[model samples]
Target: MDAIPFLPLDPLSILLLFVVGFIGGMVSGFIGSGGAFVLTPAMMSLGVPGVVAVASNMAHKFPKALVGAMKRARYGHVDVKLGIVLGIFAEGGVFAGKEIMTRLRAVYGDTGTDLYVSAIFVVVLAVVGGLVLRDALLNRSSRPAGTRQALPAAARWVRSVRIPGTMMRFKSMNNAEVSLLLVAPLGFATGLLAASIAVGGFVGVPAMIYLLGVPAIMATATELVVAFVMGLGGSLFYAWEGFVDIRLAMIILAGSLFGIQIGAIATTYVREQLVKLVMGMIMVVVLFSRLFKMPVYLADLGAVPALSPSLHGALDALSVATLALALLAGAGAILIALARGIAAHRRRHGMLEPAAVD
Candidate 1:
């Protein structure tokens, strides 16, 4: 295997990375998983290789996840037992994912690996994002006040099935009894996607909600535990190959920690429906961002006609802009929701005097 080169980080680059990290962490704290999608592409745009961007992002993820999980756990959101069980199985998937990534890099080089990752991003984000968005829109319009939303039909069906000895009960899941056999596959897929794209929460959170019957807040919080486990293990594997960039990881971590705290707090302020909305919105936007980059990768691999340098540059610029837009849209939504929630809370508490008692 050829040694992967690390890009030099100037002051401006460091500042930009820190900002992106902060936004990514904020989104992760709110939605359970998202920072990686933006961070990976942002790093690539900065000239970091695909593998190193993923490896470094993973290295930073575990610690940030630890902090976010701890914060949410304080609010009684995290399910430690469930997260641990799922994470244990996810480790196996992470190793499997790493193996596939290694082979791709060795055989097809960086461009091939980037192409593969981007393609997966496009498909997963499109399908899942569309479904979640549809659900969010429905909930916004049709849901009754003071009533919890119903689980999806698929989730209800899963909850009904009983697998005798394989059944495991989770207090966090309302003491729901589910088969370990069923849970393990979701964890594996989550880990595999995480290793491949640096954001497994895309699968993990939704699976917890729609399949495992966990609530949205709990699902998001619990995913941090899985992320921590996968990120730690994945980082070790990547670091062994000298692909992990400590400096880059630390810079991102610095901003992400602060963002994570704020994001977690925001979750307490907003409704579950909003969480789905933000996650879906970010996914859809990021999907387009990755789609824009696909042509560049295809041209590089000679799978398509060679793009002129100017056209390639234009496409690359557009891709980066779209990625930034995804982050901004997510952050804007969270901040808006948080602000509204806080104002309502204050009003209920009579924090503002009634017309100054005039």
Candidate 2:
């Protein structure tokens, strides 16, 4: 087999990718949809070819998702059968997405390819992320802290649709028969977005939570199952095309596994709504970071003026800063939440000890 050339192993790049993967993994484990948003772009900035960056990221995603999902399943959050059914559709969508990407590349070359992807990321994140953030904020503002666990309006609407013949019962859906017809379109769209942006769970997890009546905790955990299925199929296709970068995949896997383990265990104690709110905030910020890149791509495709060199530099710096901020904020939130939960657990145990003595 012909070997693909490796990007020269720079210590800085390796360190950066590992750090990026670690934080991204933590976010994915906690929130269920952020590794590739950070990983693929980080690699691309280090001069990995776009497709290779995506392919390697996809390869890493399957195992990480598998581990995370299994861990969350033990916590009683994942709906195995529902995730599988949705995943099968997502898998088929991955093939379709790959074909679209291939055709787009054939026609438009590298610049167009970049433009198309950045645009999709910006648009999807803007709409989806905005809704998520809005809902989170609304929840925080309107409800008392102790009683803020109800589904959002979107979930209520979805449950009320009552589409006949399309309802299927899933243990994760509280044994309710949710509309698979609804799930299919959502899953397929997620797959297409995954093919485009390398992270479909951004859409998939949120959709499950806000639109499909799943709890935020369950939605985030279940997204890993979907990610595993889609990533497995995506990896096979990329491997067939000889695009897998095993070294990068392994490096990312190393850091991500540690992060996933921490995140999985942390979820057992943190408030689920807080996790959802934090994830929602991160999504909105990341959406803008991608949006910042779209103008450059628009210029490349002749849809906008070539930005002034200084202006472009400023935008690039701002985008990087925003992305870094999002990563730090997310990781920090998870760690803090985890620590608080752990401390609370210990305090409760201490209280129980006095009662035992009595």
Candidate 3:
């Protein structure tokens, strides 16, 4: 068997990883589930193999989620019961998704795995990003995505269904009973996405909000609960397979630990309309990044005619650069909001005891 491709990290790469992890932490803290979407792709951009990137990102995530969950819990944002039940099923999905990755790797090799991961990224981002963008555009400035409380038609329909043995209630859903059958598939998808691309929040948080009548803040916070479960479970399996690089996980986790708290705080201050806008744009931009990567991976797999070294290098650079810019774009919005929010809080409180409202 080929040696695990543990790329020797240089100073610049290590610094970049730290930066990515911090911003990713902010994303998770604020948005409730995503730093991994950016983190795994960023690591891959840094020459880590695709599986390794996902595995290491998983390793760093559980602790960050635990910490983030605790912080948000202080604000009464987390739904532990909902999170745990969904998370249990999500672990099963993680097992299946990781198994799929391993088999693909054993067959078509790293390039194949790269191609598969990039393909999933493109599809998921395109569909989800487009929907988010449309909602942001159509939504009134007065009512942000976060503050809208009335359930969508789908959620209402879901709530109306009464399965005798399968229904469960949640505070986030206003104590309405939702079916475990529905919850299982959603949890499975979240786990699969997390294992495949190192992100479940992209799928989980949004699903909770739009599909299950969850409030956006609660959905995001509760996703941290689900994330904690999946991250810990997935990390064990990845580590057993020798896919994790502990050093990389630690460096990234160290930076993200601080960033996640800042991000979680920003959620209280920042408006969700802007978050939705930036999030949609980031996904769309990253769609292009994966698109740029596909041909390169295809050529390597001999699924396409070979390209000149110059062309291959150019494509690779484009994919990495695009991924960086997309992630940075999202982080920039959060950071700017964080700065403004903090300033406003100090101005209003004058460093005295802060008020009780967001």
Q: Rate the local accuracy (lDDT) of all candidates.
A: 0.88, 0.79, 0.87
Model 2, position 297: C-alpha lDDT score = 65
- For candidate 2, write residues 21-64 as lDDT tens digits: 89888888888774687777667656675667777888999999
Model 1 ranges off by over 4 Å: 351-358
Please say which candidate is ahead in lDDT: 1 or 2: 1
* Model 3 pairs in collision: none
Clashing pairs in 2: none
**TM-score leader:** 1
Query: lDDT for model 1, on a 0 to 1 scale?
Result: 0.88
Question: Using TM-score as the measure, what is the rank order of every candidate, best first?
Answer: 1, 3, 2
Global lDDT for candidate 3? Answer: 0.87
Minimal lDDT window, size 10, model 2:
1-10
Writing each residue's lDDT as its tens digit, candidate 3 over 1-358 gives 4568887988998898899899888888988884887888888888888888889999999999999999999999899999999999999999998998888888988878888889999999888888877776677454645455457888998888888999899998989999999899999999998998888887897799789988778888999999999999999989988999998999999989989988898888866666667667777888888899899889989999999999999998998899889878888888898899989988878646554543
Best by lDDT: 1
Instruction: List runs of model 3 lying over 4 Å from the truth.
Output: 141-149, 346-358
Candidate no. 2 TM-score: 0.92
